[model samples]
Target: MSEQRVRGVPAQPSAPDGPTPKRLPAGGQRGGPPWMGAGMPAERSLNFGPTARRLLRRLRPQRLHLGAVIGLAVVSVGLTVIGPKVLGYATDLIFTGVIGQQLPSGTSADDAVAAARAAGNHNFADMLARMDVVPGAGIDFPALGRVLLLALGLYLAASLLMWWQGWLLTGVVQRTVFQLRAEVEEKLNRLPLPYFDRQPRGELLSRVTNDIDNISQSLQQTLSQLLTSLLTVVGVLGMMFWISPLLAVVALVAVPLSVVVTGQIAKRSQRKFIAQWTHTGELNAQIEEAFTGHDLIKVFGRRREVEAAFHAKNEQLFQASFGAQFISGIIMPAMLFIGNLSYVAIAVVGGLRVASGAMSLGDVQAFIQYSRQFTQPLTQVASMANLLQSGVASAERVFAVLDADEQIPDPAAPVRFTDPHGRVEFERVSFRYDPDKPLIEELSLVAEPGHTVAIVGPTGAGKTTLVNLIMRFYELDAGRITLDGVDITELRRDDLRGRIGMVLQDTWLFGGTIRDNIAYGRPDATEEEILAAARATFVDRFVRSLPDGYDTVIDEEGSNVSAGEKQLITIARAFLAEPALLILDEATSSVDTRTEVLLQRAMAALRSERTSFVIAHRLSTIRDADLILMMEHGRIVEQGTHEQLLAAHGPYHRLYQSQFHQAAGGDDPMPVAAASTAG
Candidate 1:
């Protein structure tokens, strides 16, 4: 039989979800029309300037492509801005042709203009003197056609180049975003387990998924447009000044006004944009928890409570999104109003200059068009401030993840484990989840090759922490742990973990066939070896009963199978790995008594000629173990054979008596004095 390919993806993620961020007590997001942009749903100090700079740096690799895109934009804007002035020439041609045709055919230019002045058409005479037209000319169709065709060619070329620029920019921006995602994925893997402990999976996923996606979209939509608009402003400003300096200065008055207005709104709305995306992440976390814990929520009949929480988060998100959009939305209209005021002033001044013959009528016409063109780009820039703010906010969140503290790196020259012995030891190992509250302190122990060490402890007694330290999931705060007398830190993490196999208390299975999941432990396992592992762990019986047998599909959450079935599959996986050292933290607690006995026999065979550590509350399973260690409050209180510990009547004895007595249908609660002493 061919082996099925299994994905490395983990199960549908959601264990104990973290709490939502605290909601603001009052002020920012109730839509009270606080024009100063006061009340915020939630707020944090975002490094806006630095984050935007970092985002720009992501485009550095595409500098050549960016240069080409910018060059295209400049050429396109130049041609587009020149169109109005060229069309104004056509307007002058028609006006001068009509005026000259109304005069006598044999008249000279000086006599015609003198006649107009004598007839009290002084402005008309001044305009005629300014124009260059033949005395006998009517309309010159060929000349007019040439000017129109020239205008058409300029605009057509500009449009084509603009299209090319947009296409090139799309490729450049997408490539940059692709690189950013790869970096983010690599960063997630390098972060330590404790970092994950501090972050909720859903929130982390949001930064990786939603926030990065927002950044990509923001760049794609605005980058090209912003470049074009700014370039257009420069092109139009030059044209306006060349036409008439007076009207150009009149148009320049609106720039500072627009800048001041936009800056005020932007400064206030940026924090709101940050709050908006934060609310989105928090809301996403709540939804993920509610989805994964749907069964638990229903079983506990806390449906109303969950709904109420969802409603509150949903409302917070709505308020924040609305505030960010509405406050920033004001920029477009405010800018348009300022530009209009400048437009009216320029129009009034240009007309006076044209009537005084200081400017030609065609120049005044082109100047009006230039003023509109100049103000338009500013309006466009103001309109995009919200999107820019939103994207920067998301980028800041993603940057935070990338900048987090990574795990202590592997040694430069790692020690090789050519052939691992089963021996393991803790040399005065001290560690804690928190510095102020020590959990494990100066604890030392040893396990000889081919020995079984059964750890018996109540909840919160550091049983799991001990095993985790063995795996190097969390670094020790002090002291050292070793395998075969060499410090574990000296060995590469993968090399050390490769020699150890673990079956954690929480079972996880990816989306794959049963065969694939079992083969995940050793992808090259033979068919016979896989069947042997399945039979040994009691998974064979249930798997054969399924319609697809070993090929039966397991959902991402493994929800189609029973909990015991999932546990059996994971055990079979560990068995197939065939590592030198084994750690089982309540590996068989899910199976029934009938199945437990069979697993114990299989485990014993597997434990033979190898080292193993078993953690269990069921005392009967570890009775024949070579050594037994009882832990309390992060310290091992006793270690000996099971019989020896029972004779000693220590905490292990009290725990064993309570369990055995219960099995025999009798109450054997520890005495008050004994419990106090144990504490």
Candidate 2:
């Protein structure tokens, strides 16, 4: 498939027929109207087991901290479980005091207890014996005060432990996220160029920024909470069984039912959560595309179309999100209802037991409290299922990036050049982005040291792909590319690329001072060297004109500067690198005619002692080239000097006649010549 050239840089090649732009269907995929589909990519299914395992593996580095956090959570939950029982003890003390005051004035304690047992009030009698009762005397105020104080202390300690656990967990979560983000950034750098070509930048950014943030928040808020919930359930259940096994059995019945309900709801809701984020990523992609191409959209009068597209995506996102939240939302209330039913049943049965002296009032109260505690955690855990699902989905996205295949790895024992002179050669090289379609086949060329090799080709003739191969950005499907007689694949990528400098058609500059941007390739460059490179690129005139000169900070993508100025700064960066080989892919396309002349003069000087490959549409720019390789269909159709090609009257001859000749005010003898040659 032929690739389209954007100004000067060739677009990545696609299928011969090209990918059909996905159109909004007349009736959408689901049989709705044209606007219903939102054109979103299909959502990927979640494989929870593997993804969860991979995510947990990332926490290996923080295992010690995580273990400590779990320990603290256990301690905090233990105190929480003990605190309620202690409060029940205080209640028993108050009940005993009140009952002692109500005893008949003349009745002896032993006789009263015996009469209570005879009436099947054995539990009441047991309580009477435990109380320090004096006939017609009030309750023991000191003992009740002590019990209340103990309950108060237990609660206070539980609160303190919870606060401390949260504090420790926050640091652990932040650090883990920081490490995760760092690894993702590193992985991006290592990934092959093809990986990027297949995905949108905004979607990848969503994974790195948004997905990671979700995982971080879940860890911070939900991880400890989940652990505490489990611990509370275990501790509360133990206390319940200790108080009364029969009551514990009744409470346990709700456990399986809650699990069944939660599982059924979560099984459906998880997919929706995955779809929600998928749609969210699509929405982000749309916004990123619109903002980046705002000028194009305005110029084309596509505002209505853009808005309609965004609306469709927004609606889809809303549907997915609402479905996920609504389904998951049933868990908390469902668990609550089930929990309350169990509580009511336990209350009725326990009340009967207390009346028949089968259980004490305080014991029943404690059992009821334990039942609440038991169900409370179950409800909490059911609620957390949603967060866990969302987190797992986010984690799956993040891990997908981390697991992406990296660029063809560097050799086990890489070679390097010492004092290298750039003499590149392609030996029977064959490459194709897709194996089904071969682009460059048996392509062979030699670029001698310190010579300017100008590659002239129609779009999709593999001009940019050739340079990409030289830079080792894409590996050859067959054969080898060598630099100064050393096979490039055997050389360390850093070492090979260190000696090669590229100034692409699209200039990129980070947010930094002009000097910093210029010194990007060589961070340790001196002020003198920076100024020299800037002067060579004719950027010094503009730099000196600015109030801050070299210190002027450029906005992101150098938006603060004009396009032409950004290109000059990038050229200055390349010059500062002082590489042995230089690839100028339409480097001067953005500059004005006058600036182009100055740049040509500077390039001429730089090209004299360094190997350079120039790709440009302007034939006049390469008139002085040492060798010009005319390419067609990824083959070298012609080769030699500018005069040699023009005299040959071949493809390059026609291109010059139609483009350069017309630009120079010559009569347009063949207006269709360029297109014919391109075909």
lDDT (Cα) of model 2 = 0.79
Per-residue CA lDDT of model 1 for 384-503, tens digit only, reads 899899999999888877887777888999999877888899988897765666677899999998899998776666777787788777788788988988899998777777787777
Model 2 per-residue lDDT tens digits across residues 324-350:
999999999999999999999999999
**How much is 616 displaced in model 1, in angstroms?**
1.0
Model 2, runs deviating above 4 Å: 1-43, 115-135, 660-679
What are the lDDT scores of the predictions, listed in order? Answer: 0.80, 0.79
Task: Report how far off residue 584 is in candidate 2 (Å).
Answer: 0.4
Worst 10 residues of 1 by lDDT: 1-10
